[model samples]
Target: MGTYKQQSHVVWQCNYHIVLCPKYRFRVLTGLVKDLVEHDIKMLCQWKDCEVEELSVQPDHIHLLVSIPPKVSISELMGLLKGKLAIKLFKSYPQLKQKPYWGNHFWSRGYFVNTIGLNEDMIRRYVLHQEEEDKKEETNGKHFTLFD
Candidate 1:
């Protein structure tokens, strides 16, 4: 559980469950790639004064429970996370650029987010099982897009 943060005139708990995937749902998040993503996310959260309560990096997607400050908007935070990760990933693994993604974009256009309140436990469980749940889904040899 995140401790209450005291900002100018308010005491608040701003926690969220955020999930996102790579462009075209590519299963590239493995081995060193997975380690890089995890490290980058932790560093980003530390830089932004946020707390990462839980994190799961699946082959095709990422699930995170984070506590962001009240001063930041979810969209702004997501933009920073996605944008920075893309840049880092591209630089660290140049071969990734050869993949079929438009304008060097490494992630999809949108993401999934939910607020965490009293149901933090439930959210934690969900994040933990993300990989298992995804593996159970029958894609029928077809790729799925979140935006679709």
Candidate 2:
């Protein structure tokens, strides 16, 4: 269940369902790479004072249901998360620059975001079960497995 947050003159429960994919829809998210991505996402959310109610990282994309404060715009938050994650990933794995990938780009230029209104419970359930539902066959010899 989501809780209301009280500000100076507002009480809110602003939650959103956000989905993002890798650049060119590449299947590079697996094994250690997946772990790092998930960790970085949690760290970033915490830094932004946002709360992640549920998260699922697939082989090519990610699903997150998060509670954000009224003061922050969705685009600003998304940009920060995506930008910082790319920087960290690139730094941690310089070999990714060799082939099959290029430049400073990581995530795709666009994302899918929806506000959690009356369907908050339904959205939460969907996000929670996304891992099992989004499971894909191993690609590039990298097995797809769920990581906390």
Candidate 3:
């Protein structure tokens, strides 16, 4: 049996995903989204102790596959990523503050965080495929307005 205890600063693969405003349902496009996701992921990866392997941004939410050191809590990781990304987003696109965004949130509250170890490949595929599944849901035409 392996111990669950965390070793200090040990690199642990982590995934964090969150949503944007519901207004993006029909208003946003996936083209520039790669730029947005890339910018943030690049910054996070450039930070002292974070490495982002895969990242994609859909109209509604963002999917990030990353590895972080043990010293950071999931909460801390989210805070740093969100705070930095939000500001960078607004600066990159000045219209972000004036238009109909996912409810003035810039970013949805709460996030989906998963710890990766043995099943890293499986989890990475799952996270990366979120956009494809989301696009496949046209039958229902249902959307999540608020960050759940």
TM-scores, each model vs. reference:
0.75, 0.77, 0.57
Q: How accurate is candidate 3 locally (lDDT)?
A: 0.61
* Reference-based lDDT, residue 142, model 3: 68
TM-score of 1: 0.75
lDDT string for model 2 (1-148, tens) is: 3578888899999999999999988988899999998988898898888898898999999999999988888998999989998988899998777678867898899999998866768889999987765554343434645872
lDDT at 82, model 2:
92
lDDT of 3 by residue, 1-148 (tens): 1223445655344444433332334445256754776676667756746666667676666667666656667678777777777777667766667745642446666676665555668879989998888877844676665564
TM-score result, candidate 3: 0.57
Screening candidate 2 with a backbone cut-off below 3 angstroms (N, C-alpha, C), the clashing residue pairs are none
Which tens-of-lDDT digit does each residue in 1-148 have in candidate 1?
Answer: 6478788898999889999999889999999999999999999988898889999999999999999988888998899999999999999998898836445989988999999776768889999998777776745534477776
Candidate with the larger TM-score of 1 and 2: 2
Top candidate by lDDT: 1
Per-model RMSD to reference: 17.5, 18.5, 17.7
- The per-residue C-alpha lDDT of model 3 at residue 134 equals 89
Which predicted model would earn the best TM-score? Answer: 2
Higher-TM-score candidate of 1 and 3: 1
